[model samples]
Target: MCSVEGAKKLAAYQAVDNHIKSGYKIGIGSGSTVVYAVDRLAQRVENENINIICVPTSFQSRQLILKNNLTLSDLEVASQLDICIDGADEVDCNLNLIKGGGGCLLQEKIVASCSKELIVIADYTKNSSLLGQQYKKGIPIEVSPLAYVPIKKRLEQLYKGEAVLRMAVNKAGPVVTDNGNFVLDWKNFDQSLDWNKVNLDLIQWPGVIETGLFINMAKKAYFGMQDGSVKVQS
Candidate 1:
């Protein structure tokens, strides 16, 4: 494996071994990094016989659970989760994260809210002192398809950044989220602004579903370093 891929695997495996326990309900997150996390979870179930019910945060996550032959539950059955292990686009020093680079932000945040603790697993390149310092994909904003234009214009006017519809490379139109909502990548925003307040404000707006900004949510983060050591930040 390449260095980055190796790092991601290391972090995911470590996070699973450290946080997951027998008879606990876990929230599975989306994206490439999470793929490794699921692999580790499946291994633990098979080798150690550690039984756990997995609650998926996205369609991709649900598929992963099924493909791994791990027991799967929905929010209705498992409203409260023991812990959530997810990946981030960027993780700041304060543990703030910019997620949803893969259009799974809405469900990811919902599942996180239901979990007791959130553990972010990532590669070293995703760690930064600020949200936009390393990751440049921008804050993903899941919005109503009908009001995307107004929300885009309003966000640009207030935040002084570009909000573009995320397009699908393989598909013909914009990238539709699992919730069937369109995503607006609000890039180049003022990094100095209070993200906590910004997140609250954004959620209250009409046609706004959820933002990629995960402020004051994570309990801790584990970053797989280039040298193959895992770095833990809380």
Candidate 2:
């Protein structure tokens, strides 16, 4: 059986091979799965001599571009990206996703929204029939430090689920995002709820910056199967 990491690599490489074009501006997302995508992109730059500019979704993503020797550009210069390749914590049949598991949701969404096409790469484990089916980390919501408590209360009041502050694993207190914001993981949502409406409502909250629920955003997805094959969904 192909290992999970191998599956990630397979999906990443497949996405790059299929969607990447010469002289494209790419949005590199942040996650363990996206690491393979960055590596493959670097290899493509070297072997194919493709003139591509990579725009990072976070500080971590920028570092990956540097480490891999890929040409890095900012969103300011490339406002309209050709494609954005990203990893999701979970992806449904409709290609809607649960991102922000790596605390880079704000920038990821901004970059994805700016791109012409958003391509997701993941292992089969992330593919699900519904939003919360596979990923139990709940919907991550980025909020201002001053508004986290109120926003959490508001979300719980609206959704009837517990919206808990995400704490840092290696450090004390809540997890701070690349945007210097706090994250609230809202768990136990009704799996059957209309996520598009939910996402719209959540973002309307006073302190909410962004939500992990990426509604109607992804154009395509590549999932690596256990058999070392790839599944393309659009």
| Candidate 2: residue 63 lDDT (0-100) | 97
Give residue 118's error in model 1 in angstroms: 0.4
Candidate 2 residue-wise lDDT, 5-123, digit = tens: 99999999999999999989999998998999999998988898999999999999999999999999998899999999999999998888999998999999999999999999999
Best by TM-score: 2
**Candidate 1 lDDT by residue in tens digits, 58-177:** 989999999999999999999999999999999998999999999999899999999999999999999999889888888999999998999999999988889999999999999998
Clashes of each: 0, 0
User: Local error of candidate 1 at 151, Å?
Assistant: 0.7
* Superposition error at 110 for model 2 (Å): 0.3
- Please list the C-alpha lDDT of all candidates, in the order they appear: 0.94, 0.93
Candidate 1 runs further than 4 Å off: none
Candidate 2 residue 10 Cα shift, in angstroms, is 0.5
